[model samples]
Target: MIVAPPDPVVLAGLATTRPGPAGASLLRAGLHARRLLLLKTLLVRVQRHRETVAPAVLRGFEAGWLLLERAERARPDVVRAVLDYPTTGAWLAAALTEPLGPGLDRHLAHLELLAVTAALRAGVEVDLVVDTPGGVLPLPGVGRVESGGAGRLRIDARSRAVRIGGGDGTGSRAVLRRRANGPARTLTGSGPGWRGLRALPGGATRLEDLDPYRLPPDMGIPARAAADHADTDHAGWADRWTAARRLLRGTDRERAIEVGRSVDAVVPLVPRGTRAIGATLSAAPGAVLMTPSAGAADMAETLVHELHHSKLATLHELVPLHRPHPPGRAAPTYRVGWRTDARPVAGVLQGVYAHLALADLWHRAARGSRAPGLPERWRVRSAQRFDHVHDQVVEALAILLESDELTNEGREFARQMRKHLASLSSGRRALA
Candidate 1:
């Protein structure tokens, strides 16, 4: 028989996964992608639309809770540390698979883990010190907010408490096992063994104190990231496309849908003919990466870039693509390149191609450029044309140098990124 009631907060989450009218309508409004639909219709309630959405997000999470439970049993340490928040349920589900066989992919889980580690540190504190179910814990203050530190989070001022969506600091963590000891690791690396994780400097997660709708333990994201995450072109790339769609009203709707199609189209493209991914692309059939979330034409770039690899695979006749490299310590499930030279800028070149292609789309659609015929206007519009390219360029350059970076050119990149993002920020600026 079962021992406990699966945590009241978690139970409550299960009960409320059904999105009410507002959520359903929002889901209906932005069904561009099924995953996007999940984010919008289901995730928003858990992360953002608390009053109207808590029930639904929780319900979805709860429905998915068994996955978390299994993770606890299998790799308790990994899942506990990685799948710490409700937003992470999807990731948890994805991560649960053995991943060594065919039809196994942990891309979303990998990305989510990277993101949530920062989120946990943010909500808890950089040098956070607090109490936990295990014992006293101390979280080293990430000290400052940077790209790695969750680039200026979006905070909830009214509650006087900081939080990330699905992260309430109050929800119970699905601990598989509590190891006795270890040196210490940050929340990102912290696993079921609380040995290395910190308590952070706040009151306890208050797991028992939460209302049915209140955030569960470990639910809080840091207070520093009070601002929203902007995309390569300064577009408001909130976690979910539903939020993006809400903001993408009026003229942007068609464009947003077009972007969705553009991004989604890549999935089928790569899966079709992936015999040659190594000569040029290096990545494999499942190795292709994408981020049509915000800023830049990342969607098209990957479609084009990886497609280049797919054709490369065909050229070389490499059956299953493989490149064992990623950002984390584990075998690299992902790979990114950095620009060694700022001049003849390779990143800039890519940015140009991406922008020009999207520009072609814009022209073909006959959507007049906003505020054309100006110096800065040209610069900004140009950035939007290849938001993905520019975003990647700046990010790559930053990695390459990694010292007092963000030079004038980098600033220029940021400036244009911000503008293009702003154009999409209101969410009302969809394609023509």
Candidate 2:
């Protein structure tokens, strides 16, 4: 029989990390967490279905459910806490199940997040693995791990290292150091996934191989997108990808990896006129589509922007942040700092949350860059970036606060967001 971990003990780990730059931009993450506990307690009065604990998208995760049931029996409170966060458990399950097309890496990352976070909450070393063609690959989100193959990952949470091989148990195995610094390198084989970050061009792996879904219908269909622009005339794609990687590898590497752990794939689309630099599918949780970027920072910001959409899309599957817009009213849209056109409330929220992430990344990137000789403008620009994006975020939050579409819970979320954003900018004087 699985033994449940005490809630107070697991909860201490949650308290260990607070919201803001220190713990990464899980901005106001605690609000939903606290709200979830309250909601779950109330839901016990009206326990709907066993499926209520999981999202519809995750219904296919039969294997994960088996594992999760074991986890639940062992740590019911921890399981409930992970489920209470709108997307954690669902995303974890969906990742395990291969809910959409490619993105095994994305799925594994979420699984790692679930395992590690649960362990923290449970105050114990938790271990789990995903069944792959080769063997069962470990999922230890906490510590350090290198991922490759069909998203094959080996993370060492404390002393627990992943064993790689077939079910027959005849392949190689390696241990990882969780706190080791510098670039995390993957042991080579098969195609790229998370390890695509470290893979070389013209290798066996192609961008399309890693990100198989070229045109996700949710983002609307487009044409003329290339894998890396290496073979095509679109040198711009190659340049942008290179620069974005440079930024990730150099200054923003650690945090970018932390932020991008949720991203399943980054799909670049051929630019359609002067609109939309990037898009993320609401239906497909981890895929992000991008147009040619203006620069490395722009590309990084775009990833941050679309990742917010990806995250909310996952959470949205579990909870309704706002009531549907009035059926007959013309779809009203609001102005966002990043967009020239007005957007609907949902789009506005996506943009604001995305900007919050962007602002934080830039703030950290400018100050914490390891490489020297970054433009003076970047240091000055950090404050400017924060001001512009924070203003937009505040503006969007105001609308969300005033809208009748928001549920009481939604309003509280917005209130928390507003307060969070305010606290972030509380110390800033007017930028010159």
Candidate 3:
């Protein structure tokens, strides 16, 4: 689980919010390595806190850890997939943040569930006991098993078949079938206790995650709310995503490929009118929470914008973009033109970087007729959007350049952004 810093050229390209496929792949690899390292650190912490952890929980943790190592040795790719799942990161963050108590126990127990998922995917034998907090066993990137009560859940995986039994005296039993190469499929000939993970129709992108543990606690989106929002019109959501990807690929094939590489899962959010709301968590590198929109162009822009945040978040992990906050002093805040309230330097940087991409997106769309399906009204509006977001990005970049909170790498990144913005402005003027 060795991680390396991004190449200087890659950093510069990412600063411009246009890391090509190669750069994006590099970032993805670095982020994946970081996640694997975090998993190891978490396991070490669990071991140190064994005294506080219940005896049963401690034994379960040890078993899961051993199984994880075995699966990693047998099928590294399958184990890596389980490690890179967005929920895995969220679970790691939760487990690390929780104190030594029942809260810690509850979160640490998720590692066993993750191990079970990896074992099932790797085709390794698994006979493990995991805590089912609310009568639910969530296999990240796979589906969930819902028993009627909360207690321990027994999972046994042999060959390509898995048997799940409720350990809470409910006598609940369900069986799941797994593929020889891919993720575990939906229940086959099993009792009525679980549902499969639904995927939206995007050629190479996984567009939806309905898992209860999809989001971290700090994200403020309750599992029930996300589940409710995901329940309606998955076909409609798939149609909009297909249209959006088509529009993006038509406009810029490189960027469409980059988006598919950077974004692994889309957590659907409740929409607000015609506007699409979106958010990216720093801890979750490849996941974006976005509201579904019927407008293809709007969805395309949201995807690019959120992808910028995801990339920047991953980049910051390897490179110290901002200076550490002073021990007792509050971090200084700035007023970026896009947001109403003042924000810290990191937030400002994220906004500027994302908007820079949006500005470029609209700039190209405003000038070119490559995407014939783009609405004429949107084409007309592209100029206005370009000017508005372009100015906002310029203003935000100025703040970042002037701030003392940025490290040398951060300053260089901002300068590279300035260069990109200048190029975009020159292109706009040439069209004018």
Each candidate's number of clashing pairs is: 77, 2, 0
Better of 1 and 3 by TM-score: 3
Off by over 4 Å in 1: 1-86, 89-253, 258-432
Candidate 2 TM-score, true structure as reference: 0.50
| Positional deviation of residue 251's Cα in model 2 after best superposition, in angstroms | 5.5
Each prediction's TM-score against the native?
Answer: 0.21, 0.50, 0.91
**Worst 10-residue lDDT window, candidate 2:** 197-206
Q: Using lDDT as the measure, which candidate wins?
A: 3
For each candidate in the order shown, give its overall lDDT on alpha carbons.
0.28, 0.48, 0.76
Candidate 2 per-residue lDDT, tens place, 374-414, comes to 55565567667876677777777787777777655456556
lDDT value for candidate 1? 0.28
Between candidates 2 and 3, which one is better according to lDDT? 3
Error of 1 at 156 (Å): 26
The residue pairs found clashing in candidate 2 are: 10-121, 333-343
| Model number with the top TM-score | 3
